[model samples]
Target: MRMVAVIAAAALLTASACGSGKNDTPPPATVEVFTWWAEGGEKAGLDALVARFDADCPGQRFENGAVAGGAGVNAKQELTRRMARHDPPDTFQAHAGAELLDYIDAGQVEDLTAYYESWGLRDVLPAGLIDDLTVRGKIYSVPANIHRANVVWTNPAVLAGAGITTPPKDLPAFIDNLAKLKAAGVEAPLALGRDWTQLMLLEAVLITDLGPDNFAGLFTGRTDWRGAPVTKAVNDFTTLLGYGNLDRDTLDWPQAERLLIDGKAGYQLMGDWAAADLEAKNFPGYGWFTFPGNGNTFQWLADSFTLSTGASNITGTECWLKTVSSATGQQLFNEAKGSIPARVDVPSSGFSPYQQSAMTDWKSATQVPSCAHGSGCSQAWQSAVNAALRSYSTSPDPATLQAALAQAATQFVRP
Candidate 1:
């Protein structure tokens, strides 16, 4: 079946170029695809996509340009440097929403509205997602998958040992469970990682304390940052931080996930990508629940690929984008990545249990974007929030953190 698809793709590639006088120049031999999927489940997903690219575009080599970091924290800095030097990769991974605004504003990424029309993507991709990918009526990237951010991955055995039969439904209940887990000999009842992971936890707590509408409003200036609800959320976040590991400042999400996988911690609040990692490592009896107080809401983010404005290999880059936007590519990538396909037409028959549930929730739940994952706000706004979080992590002062956040909104949030 795979071979047949490859042969068909090759025939289509040949037929499409036959009548065009523009085919005088041979296509580039290799396409350098840049991303931060350097390890664990993220890497597995990228590997699957690369395999699909190899099969579908047999003439073009797939050059891996992966940089290591959680949430592309390090990779974004590297990408900035590359872009400044006018050496951007053929295509690079980016978050699908407000994050792409930076590149779009700078004219660093090509307008992909034409590509979307040509590929009939508007027919298959969710309308909400296409809207998220657009800025000034032009889409700049092709989203690969939709990841739910408000998930609490659990070690079921650890919870059972702590005398907790069911997952917590609210912040207070969750805190109580943490206490029980700690009393039952768990070192860190909540496993947390550095900057963005901590930010993700805070966002989940925001959803709990403010509700989905209010939390989403925080990004759009519809909700005030100085409101009592935000203050309460921050306090709740600080309280939860106390139950996390002391080494959190030094670790990334994958290390924090290991704490739960090894039973040293009771839960890890993360995106559904953790499911892929747990499955990859063959960790048994792992379970998941929506983060406490986040019922019926899906806090979401999308990983997307953008074609550079002056990409050295337009043919190779378009080939990569086409493969990424296809249902087959989305199926292979999302199944391995523990995300649901961005394309609504992709079937959920063989996805993991967590992904299947996520797909259902994706359709019915109230959806909100993730600030930590760059969907809810601009990169500058997210950076300002992260700065506040870094200071709060060390000082544990809720008031100071709240002040910093309000100030960030003043500086960055548009009317």
Candidate 2:
């Protein structure tokens, strides 16, 4: 009987050990996604992508580490801090071109070339875009969406009230319209925001004064910043700024956009993302046009995702990247994001009319990279330009600003 009791006790002990072993198995990993999409249409787009991730990446939890700031100014600062401390998120949003070169040079991101092949991304994304994303023949990130930076959003009622029936076709006409709107009792005829928004305005004016090739050449050191064309662009930029809000420096893009939305301002020069914001707010009858004189050119930027080198959840990170690059994921995100899918295979049937128009333009327009959005210039270069503009904003010295910009290009432009 004692022997029988010993056997039963041993069996019970074994059963308890087995149960404990089962309980000790680790839970699925959570993906910590870092971005600067904390509000408005950008946030909604992210949320939709997260929902898709939940369905496709089952067993993985999604953690949002979004920071709030227009143009990712705050988020990029925070990300720089985190990366310096070696606390990288699983995946982070990055502009696909020169901005990503900083991380690549630092060896902070992984080479995604093999994954691209496995996922057949090479076949789906545009060949020109693939060339732009590639650095020394290796791609480091996957593009999520393509955004047009030179779009001008207008409040139709404000325009009609100012007796403006058609959009301006050139810089002279644009300035004339601004004057007309101001004379019609609008306090701020052109909506302006922080430094980046101003930088965008400057770039649009450059395209107008310099034409597509010369404007693009400015980044490559082929166009002279000290020349007459750029000077004309700077003068035009200043003229346009005169009609902007007196309190512009304190406002973010969304706040500036609100000026147009509420019918206080006639036009806002911003990215295509404003369309999504307008849709989200249920604002209708909004009008859009390419920045005056940028009619045949598309100033483009792409929001992409990078795989951090030391990500805590490699599986989850890979899952997130795959989902973001997939056609369905791009469709879901772009439909609500006010941008077009990076993948060419994604259909355009469900996108907003503005987006559909942008899609057409994307195919036929002369595409150029946007310095304000980190495609045409490096982060350091962008910062330098922003500093110059900020000082110019307060002091309004065109010569001094032009000199500073030329110095920045000399320092940051690569051979």
Candidate 3:
């Protein structure tokens, strides 16, 4: 990987020198940035990157290719169709690890170790984020932003209404508080979308409260899914699901956001980016707490761009990756994206208070690639988790969900 980066850097230097020596007119290239960031906080960040790229890389037109869906659902499916037809965008978004792994397997991405090395990322990028982007010592993607997933967005009024004084610090207390809210006649203790968002919320709780080391172990094929810790997480998630609104299955994150926006729900466990949407709604005076956990460590996932091999324009595509991962670009991108840049060296002045706090927690913590959320686990495991938990929208059966979780945990060991 280091050798590939060295050679690529040398090649870029040679190309730059040779190009600089010539007065030959180069044609402008059209670059398309495909991503699942078409609304609220995500849209802002995507626009910021495009604007910066347009300003710096003159004549490089960015095709606005934003698809609306949770966890890159529509975009990933769209990418498959494009790759099949040999027609992919100049750049597209992916969660660093498993998503990129699939593309690398299909020979659909460029090795970005050179770009990473050129930016001196070994020293500047956060180690956790770097590890997530790397596979077998090689890098295939550029991290755009660190989206911390373990936040519990709470409505202060709702919590007060339920007579809960402070955020719960452990799983047992956490569950008890939600029960309090439910008994207080709160329609939803957790403002869940009752789809993948519910699953994401559950994973956040399990990872943060359960200890990141134990959380990491689960996916690396070390932890036993049939055991108490994993079972507790399943039960906790199902119990939270026990407090959901009957119509949750139809709600997207935004609709769920609206509930918190209107002070209709007591708490919603989601990423910090959800706060960005709250900010946009001019919703005021809400509180965000780390999903109460036994440990103080945090876990995160990064959203980044992966160039498709089907890109017909290499120069444009190369430049796209180069500028997006640049220090200035990372800052601008994360600022608009409602998160922080993956680069550790970037100044932290341009973010909101919630983002600033999340960054502080992020600095002191560990990060793991989000398996079910971003890693694009196997279709079987994803379906199993979905099938197992989907019923929780109404059922909330712990035993049934636990059995399903145990069965699905077997899917991740690559060997």
Which ranges of candidate 1 are over 4 A from the true structure? Answer: 1-28
TM-score of 2: 0.94
Q: Model 3 — which ten-residue stretch has the worst lDDT?
A: 372-381
lDDT per residue for candidate 3 within 126-237, as digits (tens), equals: 7766766677788988878788777788899889988997889777888898889888988788788856777787777678545777777766667777778877777666
Candidate 2 structure quality by residue, lDDT tens digits, 287-339: 99999888689888999999999999999999999999999999999887889
Please report how far candidate 1 places residue 358 from its true position, in Å: 1.0
Please state the error at residue 259 of candidate 1 in Å. Answer: 1.7
* Candidate 3, position 146, lDDT: 80
> Residue 409, candidate 1: how far off, in angstroms?
1.4
**Top model number, lDDT:** 2
Could you give the C-alpha RMSD of every candidate to the true structure, in order shown?
8.7, 2.2, 9.7
Q: Which residue segments of model 2 deviate by more than 4 Å?
A: 1-26
TM-score of 1: 0.90
Give the CA lDDT, 0 to 100, for residue 350 in model 1. Answer: 95
